[model samples]
Target: METRSLGEHERSTSQSPRVIALANRAGAPAGHVVLSAERISKSFAGVRALQSVDFDLRHGEVHALMGENGAGKSTLMKILAGVHASYEGTIEVDGTQAAFTGVRDAEEAGVAIIHQELNLVPELSVADNIFLGREPLIAGVLLDRRRMVRAAERLLERLGVAIDPESRVAGLRVGEQQLVEIAKALSLRARILIMDEPTSALSASECETLFKIVRQLAIDGVAIIYTSHRIEEVLDLADRVTVLRDGKRVVTAPIGELSHGAIISAMVGRELAASDRGAAVQDGAVVLSVRNLTLDTLGPHGWRRTLHGVSLELKRGEILGIGGLLGSGRTEILESIFGVQRGWRGGSIVVNGETADIRSPVDAYRLGLALVSEDRKERGLHLYESIGDNIALPSIGALSQFGLRAFARERALARGMVRQLAVRCTGIGQQAASLSGGNQQKVVIGKWLATEPRILLLDEPTRGIDVGAKQEIYKLIFDLAAQGLGIIVVTSEMPELLLLSDRILVMCEGRQTGLLRRENATEETVMRFAAPGMAAWPHGTAS
Candidate 1:
């Protein structure tokens, strides 16, 4: 779709005046054109991803690439990254024809890509990860540990990230891991950098650091290809804009040439109903209750505190949203209730008039509870298993009898969930990893649905999926709620929370700051509660 539509599809803000500084850079003197592609076309198994597409990136310019999910943005970037190269296209770099054989070839050609999903060896130290393949060696044999550490520290400092080079990659949070990827790209001496949805999972402050780095890189004459679902970032960061729809370029213009709404029109070829945000419904009863929950000072890491004497309730036939900035202990709270975060203190859970002590996910499941984790690749699915296996995993215990694993019974259960969840796959036997992101997320949800839980915990349920799939997921959530399934949705997207939630709970710095009923919750109120620094005894007076 167009820029406006894309903005509406996803959604952004400003702190300093520098937030809008990219607009001024668009009018600056042009630099050399680093790469150009002519009539580029790519197809996968007879399905065309790019058709007669023409694109070029000028050195020292931030080129914001815009498209709806599955609109070929990732495909086009992959082509440049050499992940897919058997396509019909003519690529030229610095006026010379170029061909890439693989990702290594692209890296050698000074092209680097930071994907939405980070690629880092958790067991390795930061220094080792940055120089994973091309480690500095002494006498061309042994690894030069001191030199690598020094180099990594220097690079991280340059990128404004304060991290110890000796720390293991696993010790870092998602945002820190992303920064390491960037440092690795810089280590490659990359003249061209492609960042795909780099800020999608970032907190607001983390995004600012990333934007600063991008601008500095551009000023140093590096060509940047930026893609994200958040359109305002494009309007704020891109020197030029290009929109793609259904594998074709619709428009290319400078940032000043188009308004947000106009860009949206170009993306979808028409305007969407202005009111089509998400589902709207009210009047539901609370089925799950979490009261005064706390976890004793957690170790330094992903989330410091699971819950700070936090309390909330999820109603049957209602979508309750837990709103917070990333790393604000949102996911941890969900995990605690699901019994994944053990050793929680001073919390009582009341389910349908009965109190329960849930010490593990097994215990939670026995109490009719389920959770769809945020990290689908790592925590949500069995990547090596068939779709049937993953979907039936949660309910396998109940599906079997006489202490024996039953294959036929499992397949039957899988088929039912597959139909109910509307998972699109060639067959139930397909590997879970082979399915598209939307379908993968569906499988994740289906696994929980198979458990037939009266209470469901979803953390970033629709993250990294296409618009169509997002719509389907929303409908599914509502459908489950309509069927008396109590759901607690944890999300960073404000509009999504407002649209899908019957009630909203705002968390800031691991403390419950505010609560809003459906009738009174606005984006501003939620944000205010979510902001840090205030007396922590309930910011909202609304009942």
Candidate 2:
């Protein structure tokens, strides 16, 4: 713990003028450090999450935080946002020492955080979620519906999105939910805003809108602390960059003071080799086949056909990619084959020349098939459970004897899977919730890998992972394909689909638009096929 006298604080406030501006917008006044964290150190279960790290924000600057998973980026953000109260540090706001006891204390001090993981109640309306705890009252006894809805609408409009304030959050898409979280942060009107992976789920158009809003906010004097893995966005939006690695600050410099290669080297301590373009496989036999795979989806009106006549053939030792924009039935295709019904799935799947009648996940596992879902936290891993338990969950029944759980067998399998995936953790007893985003994804995949499935399905395999972790996953996927596993990947990233897939099956509006080989699939080609009016409707059916 550290303490500062009033005289010392006043002396530190008078800093040299150094204006940091965004492109085309006027910069904030220099020497205006709105929030500052000095000598912050924190530990969890004897593991150092952060160690004497320092961070500061200007009055109207977009300061980007860059780091790999488990690099103390999230830990430092949590400390500054008041999620971790007990830490060896001193925080200051406007040259005054402040100790935030909780999230409320931080909010009251004009500081707010928008977490990577969304923090909205799914059952509540969009307006209700924005004004959750601090609701507007009509007469000190009744809820102020009109005021809240109007305020929510204003926030949504400011972000340039068309979302209904009255709509339930559960009905919105993942990207929409992310926007709602941003709107909630805007409602606070905080002077210091911390955003973690804000554009993870955003579409291209949505991202354009968000960047505009962020630039406008900076012009309006809202100091922003931005965290993201997207290099181009950080280079474009951030006025200054601060990188952390393994609980220590690597560097802090203006955006112009660093280059692309320099930033990657600083964060990873090494140059990341680019992935070579993999050629299409034309040798292996067809391990899986789906002809006219169709499924129903529960939309706003009623059950609608989400997939129409979607057919693809995946060969042994091949990486087949499913490419499409959001809501283009890319996920529904995998869900249909895995028997995870979106709305009464109707599809035909043949595995290794045999039909697979998968009615549920258990049935899919039994039929030599496994699926790694997109939402790892909600659908894949049990957060609070141990790594060993999560890894062995799918096959625990087979390892049991006389209806008694075989704890020893479970640990052995978990350890083997952990070794195979090169997961970074303390031991098998570590909870999945405590792991980084990349490690958590590995656990989810390991959970299904225990089933010894011949076919694997991955959805958004590296959504929020850092560059270093992404390289590891790419190598792991290549290794799995080399081991004769038929793999299908669903990804929204065009470059990833082009880099990893042997062949891409492009879809548009729930219809198969085109099948492009490795050399033929470019960003332009993929987007052209993914656009509307390219795919014909199945016979007489309508969406």
**Pick by lDDT: which candidate is best?**
2
Weakest 10 consecutive residues, lDDT, candidate 2? 16-25
Estimate candidate 2's alpha-carbon lDDT, on a 0 to 1 scale. Answer: 0.85
Clashes of each: 11, 0
Per-model TM-score versus the true fold: 0.86, 0.90
lDDT scores in order:
0.81, 0.85
**C-alpha RMSD of each candidate structure in angstroms:** 6.2, 6.4
Q: TM-score for model 2?
A: 0.90
Off by over 4 Å in 1: 1-30, 137-150, 258-284, 297-305, 401-416
Q: Write the per-residue lDDT of candidate 1 for residues 226-288, one digit (tens) a residue.
A: 987666778888888888888988887888787777777776677644333244343565678
- What's model 2's lDDT at 176? 86
The segments of candidate 2 whose C-alpha lies over 4 angstroms from its true place after superposition are: 1-31, 138-145, 153-162, 277-283, 344-347, 535-543
Task: Itemize residue pairs with steric clashes in candidate 2.
Answer: none
How high is the lDDT of residue 22 in model 1?
Answer: 48
